[model samples]
Target: MLTKAAFALLLTLTPFFALAEQAIQSQHSCFKGPFETYQGWVMRMASTLKKFDQEVFSAYFPESKFQQVQQTLDCVDFVYQVDGFNVEGYYLKPKLAVDKKLPVVMFNRGGNGRGGYVTFTRKLTFQAELAAQGFIVIGSQYRGASKHIDNNGFDEFGGADVNDVVALMDIIKQIPDVDSENIAMMGWSRGSMQSYLAVKRLPNIKTLIAVAGVSDVHQGMAERPVMEKVYKKRIPDYENNKQQELDKRSVAKWAHELPANMPILLLHGDKDERVNVAHSTRLAGILESLEHPHKLVIYPGDNHGLTKHRQEMISEVVGWLNTYLH
Candidate 1:
């Protein structure tokens, strides 16, 4: 969720996005998914071709028919209102859910803008996978990550943008079959920071999952200068407020503030180059000192994305969510 590389192809869908925008009524705050949008129509065509001819499918469409490729993973890329701004996000769930009201998994993605956007395949497939497993996987594209949805306002990283996440919590309650009372949140990379801040206000959060998360802004900026530049662009008043803004975003400065009752699962690769593993480990230690309920998993020889241990990470996440939220 940290890398900006995989989002290029998604930009190509801008025309299709414009078409899909017609499916939703802006007056409606909470709309159901599987809408007959132009993109969905394209994917249906691609899926039909993928069943037989790969070459033809590739030739016909610019990308894979990912939306229809999944077995039972139903995903909905949605746009909703949050503090007068249209926030972009998605929700994933199994086509055949066993429960009348499904437990919630609100995911927070990493990256500032197009940099961390994952909707078409990467993030969509990941969240869809969890949905296939029975949880309602809902996530935010924050405010300004406008790949498809014409969202308003700027992404304040963990500042005002956090309200985007919090607003989704209340918004989902209106969406039927969602177990708003029992909620679990997972944040990846910078999304981890958003998760930390969002959970602070959400006492109802059953559990927190931080995958390759950032616990400290200052420490992360020092290690990854590129990320510092990102901070400057996304975080408002970065030039003048600097340390104050960074401190406000950094969970390391206030680890004790987290609820001891709500358990946390910290997943980080020790060899991570983007955000140092020290972020999770140090935060884990602080949480330990504070007697918080948490489990830290440090994968050896893994990078920022934890690409090598993705399946294992998925298992750990699913297992943790089951333990607390299911």
Candidate 2:
């Protein structure tokens, strides 16, 4: 008694039902911690060319058709200790194992103090996407994130925060089957500044991905007056010697210090308002002048997070990690 239309509708609904079943069956924590864990299916969303052209594209896009896509991944939360404080972080692994020796990517979060903490949803989506590609992904909540326990109350911008990432390497070493030698890093916004500083300290890192990063602290202070206030508040000697403190954080002033052979991929959105595209462009020029290995890609009409070209940006990141980290 079922018509052809009914049959098609049933077929369309079948996968969702199966997904629901799997969601129930796979509902178990993969990692337990003093940190909370989020493990379940997550909808994967991406923007299209039309959305980008409209200049209305944002990470908060709710109108995109791609939001209907029901791809999901498993996620877990855990904690790693740094400097005698229990720092919160997440460890994500693919549902299916591709290799016993899985590559690792340390995701550096953006913002300062409590502004940049990676939440449960981001751990399940953005971090899980990389994990689904067969890489073990980890991220830090760092020292001063909101609601963080054992707070040391130090927000070093790119200074001690870089050590937090370096300490993660020790955690990575303990992770079973993780290829600690093939480690890579991805940083967005303020996280990019942390990545720049981390690469200098950790020579084991194979490749660097800097997205909407701050390359020049002095330039950033100049571009955004509020940054000057932030610097003065965070850096103790900012009032006495601003340039010296700025120079400590500015990668543009010390491109020569980065590992000469290590490759860096810089991604920026031309329409980025938080951190200007000029940050990446200026660093590209400096790297080129220094003959350091680097690549710079600019997405037109995209914002600080490269929200318009989400899929392309993810693809490029995976490709770069595949080429360099694997």
Best by TM-score: 1
Error of 2 at 254 (Å): 0.3
What digit string (tens of lDDT, one per residue) describes model 2 on residues 48-74? 123332223233433232222123333
lDDT of 1 by residue, 115-203 (tens): 78764545444776687667888888888887556546788889999998888775567545678888998999999999999999998
Q: How high is the CA lDDT of each candidate model?
A: 0.76, 0.72
Give the count of colliding residue pairs in each prediction. Answer: 0, 0
lDDT of 1 at 28: 18
TM-scores of the candidates in the order shown: 0.80, 0.78
Error of 1 at 301 (Å): 1.0
lDDT minimum window of 10 residues, candidate 2: 19-28
Candidate 2 differs from the real structure by a C-alpha RMSD in angstroms, to one decimal, of 11.5
In candidate 1, stretches whose alpha carbon ends up further than 4 angstroms from where it belongs are: 1-71, 97-100, 147-151
Query: Lowest summed lDDT over 10 consecutive residues: which window, candidate 1?
Result: 23-32
